[model samples]
Target: MSQKKVDAYKAEKANREKIMKKEKRVLRLEKLIALAFCIVAVVWIGFSVYSKVNEGKEEVVVNTEMDTSALDDYLSGIATDAADAE
Candidate 1:
């Protein structure tokens, strides 16, 4: 082959190799991005579910009633005792 044709072939081969490398890099980057997105989505969903499951119970309630009659009687007795002492 002529020198010009040989040089052209080498240049074309180099261009093809460069294109292939770029395509491969782009494909690898796309795969990595998809994997990262999947991981993030899974983690977000898991966290949401965990928070919902572990959240505080909203139905827990406590009811109490106190009687004050005994205390009042005791105070009245003390007042009577003090009056008697005086």
Candidate 2:
């Protein structure tokens, strides 16, 4: 084959190799993005399940019915007895 034809062929081969490398890089990025989304979806699903389990059973501390007077009254008798022992 002519030297000119051989050189042209070599240039074309090099260009094709460059495009293949770029295509592989793009495919790798796509795979990474897909994996990231999968992890996010799984975490979101877990949070949803946890919230559902706590539904209606979750208690608010401020909404309690505890009476300070009753608790103090109950503890006063115990403290008095303990002091009498001393």
Candidate 3:
């Protein structure tokens, strides 16, 4: 082989260990990131379910006021008119 090709091959061999270590570190980081994402998704889903259950357990209150005086007056007028007709 040529002198240049021999030199390049030796240089690559010398750095093979460093390249393998870098690849292992990248793979470990990817696995850690995937685990973290799964944990976060589970926590989010649990929190939403908990919140919905608690929301259903809560009581809602409604306040309203009504006046019936006009209805009473109208009924009384009707009664008087019926008596007058009789």
The lDDT, on a scale of 0 to 1, for candidate 2 is: 0.93
lDDT tens digits by residue: candidate 1, 15-86: 998889999999999999999999999999999999998787577689999999999999999999999999
In order, candidate lDDTs are 0.95, 0.93, 0.97
Q: Evaluate model 2: give its TM-score.
A: 0.53
lDDT of 2 at 33: 100
Better lDDT candidate (1, 3): 3
- Give per-residue lDDT, candidate 3, residue 9: 97
Per-residue C-alpha lDDT of model 3 across residues 1-86, encoded as one tens digit per residue: 99999999999999999999999999999999999999999999999999988986867799898999999999999999999999
lDDT of 1 at 32: 100
Residue pairs clashing in model 1 are: none
Q: For this target, which candidate reaches the highest lDDT against the unseen true structure?
A: 3
Model 2, residue 3: displacement in angstroms? 14
Winner by TM-score: 3
Cα lDDT tens digits for candidate 2, 1-86: 99999999999897998889999999999999999999999999999999999986957577557669978988998999999999
